[model samples]
Target chain A: MPKLDFDTINLGHGSGGKLTNQLLDSGVFSVLKNDLLDQRHDGAILELSGKTAFTTDSFVISPVFFPGGDIGELAVNGTVNDLAMCGAIPRYLSLAFILEEGLPMTEFWDILVSIRNACAAAGVSVVTGDTKVVERGKGDKVFVNTTGVGTVHPKAEIDIRRIMPGDKIIVSGQLAAHGMAIMSVREGLEFESQIVSDTQPLNHLVKDLLDEFGNNIKLLRDPTRGGVGTALNEMARDRDLGVHLEQRALPIDPQVAGACELLGLDPLYVANEGLFLAVVSGAAAGAMVGAMQRTDTGRHARIIGEFTDQHPKKVVMTSGIGGQRIVNMLIGEQLPRIC
Target chain B: MPKLDFDTINLGHGSGGKLTNQLLDSGVFSVLKNDLLDQRHDGAILELSGKTAFTTDSFVISPVFFPGGDIGELAVNGTVNDLAMCGAIPRYLSLAFILEEGLPMTEFWDILVSIRNACAAAGVSVVTGDTKVVERGKGDKVFVNTTGVGTVHPKAEIDIRRIMPGDKIIVSGQLAAHGMAIMSVREGLEFESQIVSDTQPLNHLVKDLLDEFGNNIKLLRDPTRGGVGTALNEMARDRDLGVHLEQRALPIDPQVAGACELLGLDPLYVANEGLFLAVVSGAAAGAMVGAMQRTDTGRHARIIGEFTDQHPKKVVMTSGIGGQRIVNMLIGEQLPRIC
Candidate 1:
């Protein structure tokens, strides 16, 4: 780490003065240095072509540092995944921070390093950013906002309008890990095993899927904030169609399930950071799942449901106990700041 | 008001659940609806070609509302002006919010309307965004992050590398108005006259200047958080050149000057929301200032300083009484949350 006179950030660090410059030069710029960022202009100049995808997300998860990942990693991965769900090649990101005064310099440095590593892992660059500090008690440790821009995959025509009645709904990997991890930490809960947040970048995996499945991939949604159940309900309502699911096919880590059970929470509604829900054509469902299972990001890929004409604007699941039940969208706040 | 049952925003509205959908459907979406936003996809798809400008900023100004403008208006214009400084015609924006729970719904609605009006006024669209609600006391009322994308102007070539020894420094309008406005409200220091923020969009004025001046314009920067002094100091230090300013030429409103005197603050270190500093070729400086003064955004335009060969990498100013003083970048915080 670059040497600094202060151990914690102060209001002057965001004052757009000498202290702000010192903080950026010795801290953020040193960690995430790039040609575009080196320009040091009001904005980054980029070359973008064809259909570009633009998205923004603000992450305010409590406890800046979580079990498996920190807020910095989550900020980068969250925006990257949002772009990936659009069938885009995530390229550039703009990171902005709302830092609370008195935050330790070490913590700030760690977050910057995490951001750098996350960007390198996702194959994207943080081209521009802004930092603002609020007085103590006015903010938490840190709040991050990441906005991503990417070029849409040429072969991909992923859209909700393309969903057919028989399209299969698939889930990539296990669910409820991210939400449970945060809850466990917040509530001081303990279990037989540890629960870690599954916060990882899904851009590369998404690129591979789009390259192979092409137009057969009808839609992709990351089950973040609200989990698989909420995403499926949104699809059903938006398409004015029904989603039929097999409960036995739903994937969940044993630890996450147990924690959910202990907390009286449903895994279906819990958030998933690194997981995604995909809607693909029936003819390619088996082959797609097979391909996805071969990759690290989708080892537990499962064809859990299919769109149907019955029960329009609703999601119905066939349980392992042989009873059918309707899965409505999440009603109230099950968990806050659970991203 | 779209018949919301609640009087204030709660954590559930940001949980990505039923209440979240209700909030979006009745509030944010209804106010900021457009073709791209109406799609309601993970991201907005736009056909952008050639050079693009991307930038992000988080607005955490206290009080939420100020004398001349609110945080919503400032957030939109701030990002737009950043793009303007890059010689880009801002086209699309991604808006994200970190809201504190218990904020009244009426206040939220008013902010939303202000955002809509500002977007319309600036000719930009809010395409994709995310909202997260932090518990009361975890955050202030609201913090907005706006990431903007714009296409670069063809004739514009904005680069500091083109700065010459005789380059003229131009201030688009009066300085310290925005800083004093926020200070007036925050400190509750009453003056005989009101000090209103000069928060306005400078994109059109910049476009016109670029269209006419082309490569003659060397660099452009908005004097936002650090005022004109800090911005000039940054340029001088980066280019390893000297900046000479005439204190008499600096424009400031009478009330603003008096407020700065009372607060023991230097106008040079104050912040400006709707002003910019332009570096132009000495030969075209007079013509450019004349042309700028004809426009609404630059009616108070003045040639305050110029790059000089003396005092390399430092800013020196001449007083009206014929004495020179070294104007340094702000050292520590004078005012926080002025933006």
Candidate 2:
């Protein structure tokens, strides 16, 4: 066997192939030496003395910072909501920062403040962090990778596997608000009404759902960069289920709808910051909708869809005029740096 | 009260003045929210249920990476030894990465691998991490900030304040080897002999010391960025004591001396990655020196200096001809990035 070179790394290292694994095994795993890392699973199976939920996310947003949140807060809240979606109480966060030098101290400070504020609002402590600053012109502003650990409630058993064909999908708020907000700022597009980024911390609203529907809440996900449509598509594929969303039933602010139309973007595919998609048993769907509407962040909550075993691994939408279409994962970057 | 501008950070933020305190309270402390951070002390006071040791350091090395270790591994081991200096069993680490993006993944991976390997060699786990990637053209390669935690045996208590005037100061292995290696690589200076980085994990040798002399050891420190001279100065300043070094007693590798002479750099201010200064009580100094010499990493361990109450806060070095001179901290970046 040839001796591995330790001088430089190439793009092939991130290709998830033999070299990637070799890099992880020889370089990363060798140093990280932990049982959890050794598992090499899609997600780590952490054993907790108390009930807990595990969540992981990869952040590759361009331009890192924008009007609302930068990659810092996005990395923090993105995983925080994943745990919250599982009805878990978020408590600890592990942060990883990849930086390119020549970046200004002012911009770094701004992002750091945002991350700190987000953790405080969510009542989670940033127990650990890693920073690596690289040479100039070699990286984008910054890329943050975060993993969250939260304690799950013993009685809360929300799972997508429980969704039946007649299950109802309640969107916690308006569609296209976050996506349009980013587009407006990035493209310098103006509207009759100024659009503000709908970025927010959602742990409080999650607690409300746990208090109301408990286990009947089958699933929850904050529709972010890929939008509500991609989120529904993931849920359908994960459980070998299908989803039918009603376009007319979806609530979209008139301004956001106009902005999407002007930009030739689909409201479903445009990102949302403060919105969550909830799948509930048909019996508890109405009560869940009622509970969500009571919160200020969820006043626009609506029953936008239903699950079906008929069209497996698909998300079909019933248009306002009765037309039908399939919703899929984003092919490339859309409205880059909306986070 | 005036509304603060959110544009850029000024030097005052790091000055440890009013602005620095405000930045800490409003930005950093607000996000961290921990008791240890709230104490507002030069060093955090951690209450150990069992036995433990405390260590603190401020890292501001330029270029961050050179021939030997980068800021990442340097940050890890620097504090790791601070604990080892106290006979503490290092077990956990907390890392903070301040990044300026546009940094190549290649450099990031190299440093990351170094950090991973260093932690493994030290028998420590990085339990928590924080990362912030700044904008392009704003930061140098990268700067890593690290804090470490370790456990000590119940019977161990190594105190620098207990050092008597006649105590022996031992230099572990060769002086200025790491610094010279960095300069050779950075300046592209080649010699008949290759000057390999003297960066080696020293926890194992520390273990040997504990096994041999235990609490009789007064203090230990890896002469890193500022070399042995600055480390001794800091000890003198902190303990309000004088340190006297005999020129003939100091150990310097022939190659290191040649490299320093070629580069016009002082060996006293040059960095040492694998060397440490140990202040020991007279009774056990001989046994400790014997134990250090027996180890592979410390074969050249020799008595270099003594402590005294005279000439307070001064580091006096006696010349080979019996003359003396003062050694002080390097005023600015020397052999930049020679970590």
Q: Score the docking of each candidate (DockQ).
A: 0.91, 0.02
Worst 10 residues of 1 chain B by lDDT: B21-30
- For model 2 the TM-score comes to 0.61
Q: State the lDDT of candidate 1 residue by residue for B1-339, as single tens digits.
A: 567778898999899988888887775457888888843578999989999999999999877899999999999999999999999999999988898999998888888889989999899999988888999999999999999999999989999989999999999999999999999999998989889999999999999999999999999999988889999999999999999999999989989999999999999999999999999999999999999999989999999999989998999999989899999999988889877
Which numbered prediction scores highest in lDDT against the true structure? 1
Q: What is the lDDT of residue B286 in candidate 2?
A: 85
For residues A76-121, write the lDDT of model 1, one tens digit per residue: 9999999999999999999898999999989999999999999999
Best by DockQ, which number? 1
- TM-score, model 1 to reference: 0.99
Q: What is the alpha-carbon lDDT of model 2 when measured against the actual structure?
A: 0.65
Q: What is the per-residue lDDT of model 2 for residues B1-339, given as tens digits with 9 covering 90 to 100? A: 123333334333322223333433444223323333421211222222344343333243554676666766777777677667656777555554544544554565566667777877787755444443444554455656555555664445565577778888999988887767666766789988877667777877887777767777777777766578877877887678899999988888787788888888888887777778888887888888888888798899998988988898898999999999997755444654353
Off by over 4 Å in 1: none
